[model samples]
Target: MRLLLKKKSVVLAVLLLVGGLYLINHSDFLMAGLSRSPEIHPSELTWQGQLLVSKESWVDRGQYLPLNVSYQLLAGAPATEQRYLSIGISSVNRKKGSYLISTLQSIFSMSSSEERSSMVVVVLLADFDTGWRMATLKDIKTTFALELEQGQLVVIHVPLEFYPPITGLKRNYNDAPERVTFRSKQNLDYAFLIHYCAGLGQYYLQLEDDISCAKNFLSSIRNRVAEQEKQKVTWATLEFSVLGYIGKLYKSGHLPLLARFLFLFYQEMPCDWLLTHFKLVMTQKATILFKPSLFQHMGTFSSFQGRHNKLKDKDFDDGFYTNPVAEVFSNISTYQKNFPNLAWDAGEAFFWGLSPVKGSYLTVVFKEPAVVTWIFVETGSGTKDLLQSAQVELGHDVVTTGKDKSCKDFQSVGAIENGKFEMQEVDKKYSSASKCLRILVTATQKHWVIIRKIRVTTKQSAPRQE
Candidate 1:
């Protein structure tokens, strides 16, 4: 009886252990299903059709032009219940002498049977003739109305200068006067337009008049909307003239005057970098999505003259460096310069550091033209001492004058240049082993070193992986 009881107890214990392990391994899958279950019914059909649209045609200044556009659906059913489409037009009228009277017409036509979604285009015009600004606005409104009436497309006219003010501006910063008023106006307009679209349960897209739509742009956007309802992305400005980081930072509800003053003084970092660093924080708290590539620019402007019409020459000083090493070093330097008070390893700031353990780390690996860097860590006898002497290998060997061979066998290949291993007593029966290691190697220009796998080995066998 005692032996039977013991066997039953052991079996029950094993069952519980196995059940716990199963839950641990499958937790992510269960959570994903709970969080991202499809909102739309599977039986509901999606729009899967293509429409080829021409680029905006230029009209003579002071002319009220009627744009006759037609949409012939390539596939899918034009069902009234599921289809939602809105169109808008925008133009620029600020340049002198040679001005372009560009007209944009959007048709949000989608079929019910399609799988992919459709996109709405927002046209942007640059270098407009300043002399005929009102004429340009009138032309745009007229063209927009005409397209709506003729094509039966729901249309909204968004003047680039029209925006509801956030509030009556108080003189907060001294540099306010030097800022470009028109640029601010445009940004405000875009913000208001996006908010307006959101309020109406519509997705607003901004596009340049010069870019012709791919035959299936609208269809694609519609499909994307169906797949992900929370695609409410705030588009970044296409013009890089704006300078301000986009992200969240934690602070006391009531900060000391000194802390507030310091924060206000140092908040001019690039927006995308800030967004990337604090993506998790912002996503959780603010419910904002910063779509980095939503605003695609045709090309860099030769010179961008603000409202003052003075020519501004901008230089691209940060030449692209290959991969993780370059990105890590650049991000560290940028953070150090921009955010001096914040520790690099703390909170979301870990996303922007030399040894970034949080978030996704991307490194570009190349075969020929190697770049090398020495990596170090600390470990020692004391807790602080135990952390002092640990270092790891990073980078690749240098290639001279010939076609360099690719190091395909290793994800990251390097040798530990320095440090010694020591075994120290923790308690009477227990001991810990420590090693101070450094690595030296050359990184090929095109090869990438993704730090996806990290391991520490004391002997040929039984290496501990991290």
Candidate 2:
């Protein structure tokens, strides 16, 4: 009797152990079904297709979750027909402030009518907060009714099932668990966004939600694409801003592979670093960055919680300056006939002046009273021929008193230290319109001066955003 009881107990223990192993192996599948909303049918998932997993360690079938994801169209739907360009922007709740509306305004207002017709702007609400998503979509729909009706704007959101286990991810580079989770989720977000926008247009432009666009930026991108075609260069990414993943453009045809790559290694690195690897794997060896960047970062708060950053792209051409018609004059003698006007004009030859004594000045007098906004002056070609000591001043109430037709009354705005000076908002001190901009030599200098650039912007020339 005792031997028989012992056999039965052993059999029961073995069965329990086997059952527990099976449940552990299939926990994700069982939990996924139980936790999913009843409204979501199997067919409603975003990507129905299955990706064949490789035996590689990075993509081990048992380690990574399945690629089947789900999403919802909260607002505008995608156009049926293809477009010339597709602009992808991803947004999340920031701790400090929201810049999504301003970013949308910038893109829509900066793009020309024809440019708008040629492209589609897709906004992905990457945050999972249901209330926040609804509120954001409401704001977007209300603000861009015409654009939504015209099929130029779209809003998409990935359902909760879109992500894998984001928390407690293997910390690479000794990153904190929170940072790892943030970047890992970011990678997944970008992957989902890239996959969604893959077939929407001929090219895909990745942009952040806290950026301002330059005027006619779409036209500039088209021109850059045309130039690439003319050169017959096989490129992966055409960068319009140096900031992280703000203005990166890629061929639409290659987006699928790029998306898959990101999804596979979502936990390993950030989205931008993954992009670099993707570019290299595609046989494009170098980053193709364009000058006069078309986007600028305007967010003071980062999307990552509890972090603050103030990032700006120096190359961004904000289109504040029309370089309005003006006459240039200088007291320093000219070199090789490189007149002072040459520095202000849109040309290669700058204002090359000989050695200057104290009180020598280079002046630019506008044809009308101008509300100056921004000024940037570069006074050196190389280590030599630099304006060693100078100060920039705003001249008001001008009378054509000098022989070169310069202004007389001046107020010091800023000084030229280290051969360069840049200032914004010249109207802060003097609300009245200014007559001229003058760069005066503070002290005598033996080295000749090369006014490499003199970029000026005014309020009247800047485009007003509605």
Candidate 3:
């Protein structure tokens, strides 16, 4: 009897715990925790509060900072005027590849001359190592000589005065755990670079020293931002990459204010952690993330001491170098002609927006009924932009003015948000109903879908993917 009672009591306790977890997850309890977070609507900020933050009383000052940093402007000049975007990269002791030069090359290679001149690469040689500093400068001077002379690559030598003067507060958490400090000086470095390059570009793009960009990454960003604007959404920061602050694109206008906000918490948190609080206090807008990650962290070695490092995303590394696309058909659907100016071309191998109207799809008409063996498709670049279900319809003939009154069985394709969307080979090859087949798409949302490349294969002919 005693044993039975004990067992029953334990079971009841477990049930109560599970019920509590369910309520917390599914009900208003979590909202209580959310309410305490710092996010505030943009309208809630007052001019006085935005402008005036007393630095003296807010936090403890940083200590054991670099005494002096030898100043060197190896290349480029200040922004002539506020440009479209400013990419701020902190090239610390990344003993890996020529991430600095290669990143610049990657940008310039993908971009047209006009696009290249539209923004500036603010490279901050921010480290205390003398040898690394000089080598970094020499390399930048040699590799990007033209960009340096053309004012496209702006390299700045960060000095001791740029940081808070020597104080008692800890700056490295690993070195001094008892006092208030950060994981690494990197938090301070980003704060320094972001503030320094605030007025340089209309929008500031935070990039890591050891990172690679995706193919047409900038174009992707421009399209995403423009789409959000079209939808009248107020976004906080647009994240181009998945890693913490890396790939985070901030409006240069907002960066100045955001930089000021971080100045108050400089000693307490990591740059990324600081961003969370900063977003809470400053704006209610949510951060926009780029799918498949535009920027990839290549540095295996951590710049900070006593830390383990791993790939930001172990599965996804595809971008400018490896991202390949197959050929697409020239014919887009003639039925739905919306946003014709920003029309999607099969050969363009990029973004395509859809209309809110149901049955909005892109179709290609084949000369003969395609005995489709395998169909390859790269869908939306975002979470919601992905197709929920794509109806693969095939028909040889159809009525134009009136309904054909024939129900067609089509292959329904579905997908999760994988970097590149490739559907499985159908159980059996699909032959067109009459002679033409249509890829009828149903979107999860009205956002654009990126059909980078679609290759259809048949038994008789080669797959025309490329």
Question: How high is the CA lDDT of each candidate model?
Answer: 0.27, 0.78, 0.54
lDDT of 1 by residue, 1-466 (tens): 9999999999999999999999999896545523432222123221222212111112212222321111112112222222243322233443221112221321221122231222222222222233343344444444344333333323223322222232333333433532334333344333322222221113334433321122233444455455444655532211211222211111111112111222222233222333333334324333332222121111112112313232221221111111121112112122233331121121222211233222212222222222221122222212211211122322333222232221222222323222222111111121111112222222222221112112111111121123
Model 2: what TM-score?
0.61
Model 2: how far residue 27 lies from native, Å: 8.0
Residue ranges of candidate 1 with Cα displaced over 4 Å: 1-92, 96-134, 137-146, 150-180, 199-201, 208-212, 227-296, 299-466
Model 1 lDDT, residue 162, Cα: 27
What is the alpha-carbon lDDT of model 3 when measured against the actual structure? 0.54
Q: For candidate 2, lDDT tens digit of each residue in 355-404?
A: 99999999998887766755678888777788999999888655676477
Model 2 / residue 131 / CA error / Å: 1.7
TM-score of each: 0.28, 0.61, 0.51
Model 3, clash count? 9
**Root-mean-square deviation per candidate:** 31.1, 9.2, 22.4
Model 3 clashing residue pairs (backbone): 38-280, 39-280, 326-465, 326-466, 327-465, 327-466, 395-434, 396-434, 396-435
The CA lDDT at 462 in model 3 is: 28
